[model samples]
Target: MILWFTYILVAIAALGGLLCVVLGLAGRRPSDLTVGILGLLELGLIAQVVISIIAPFAGNPPTGSLLEFWVYLVTAVLIPPAAVVWALLERSRWSTVIMGIAALAVAVMVWRMQVIWTVQGS
Candidate 1:
């Protein structure tokens, strides 16, 4: 895995978390800008997933279990939309808080994925 791409995604996800948390602390519901940030993060995660899936086929497989890598990748990709849907359903500042947590979770998952990619027997 390219370290720069991982760094970029991690930075964006961390920023997203901070943004949503701030919005929530301000007692505001999830706004379009917040959703847009999540949307962009989701797109990046999806692209990462695509690259991860293809890398193995291109003879650059992970040293770890490919299935585990994919599971983590998929989970990371799905988190933003699920958070958005739940945020819409709740219609409260807590929903924004949920997005913050989701973003943080995705960031952690991505980090674990990087470990899984580079560390043998992970």
Candidate 2:
């Protein structure tokens, strides 16, 4: 994994999470803004997936257990869509909060993936 891209993903996810949290706390239900932010986060995750696929061929193969890294990557890619679906169906302030939590979770998971890719050994 590229270190800089990881940082970018974390930043986007963290900021989006915080924004959703604040909106939820302000008594808002899920909105287009929240969904759009999640959509962007999902796009970033998809890009990360592509990069991970290509990086090994480019001579940046992960030092960690490849299975572990792939598992984390796949799960991280799923979170945003899951949260968005939940929010859409629930349409409650708490659902917005759940989306925030999901985004925050993705940020942490992405960071873990970075550690596994760059620091851990198989």
Candidate 3:
């Protein structure tokens, strides 16, 4: 696991969480900008997955159990899309709340991935 990448993901998720909180507080509905940001975040996650997939084959075996890594990877990849679809269907502040929760989940998963990597390394 790349510590830098994990940090970056955490930062992104934190920012998204802040935005969602602000939107919720201001009584604003989910907007296109929010969706766009979520899309970008999703792309970033996809990139992370791609890099992770290639790293092990490129002589950098992941310092984590393959099964756990796959679970985290798949969930991270699914989150943004799931949030977006749910937001579109809901179209309320609840959508933003859901996005916020999703972002928080991403952060937690990143942390877990890091821990898994560390444990495997030991």
Query: By TM-score, who's the top model here?
Result: 2
lDDT of 1 by residue, 15-91 (tens): 99999989998998999988888998999998897788678788877888778888998889889999999998898
Question: Residue by residue across 36-118, what tens digits does model 2's lDDT show?
Answer: 98999999999999999999999999999899999999999999999999999999999999999999999999999999999
Judge candidate 1 at residue 33 and give its lDDT.
82
Using all chains and alpha carbons, the TM-scores for the candidates as numbered come to 0.93, 0.98, 0.89
Predicted structure with the largest lDDT when compared to the true one: 2
lDDT at residue 122 of model 1 (Cα atoms): 40
lDDT of 2 at 99: 95
Estimate the lDDT of model 2: 0.95
Span of ten consecutive residues with least summed lDDT in model 1: 52-61
Candidate 2 has a TM-score of: 0.98
Q: List the candidates ranked by lDDT, beginning with the highest.
A: 2, 1, 3
lDDT of 3 by residue, 1-122 (tens): 67798888888887886788688667777888778767877887888888887877777676668788879878988988899899899999888878877887887887787777656763
TM-score order of candidates, best first? 2, 1, 3
Model 3 TM-score on a 0 to 1 scale: 0.89
lDDT of 3: 0.81
Query: What local distance difference test score does each model get?
Result: 0.88, 0.95, 0.81
Q: What TM-score should be assigned to candidate 1?
A: 0.93
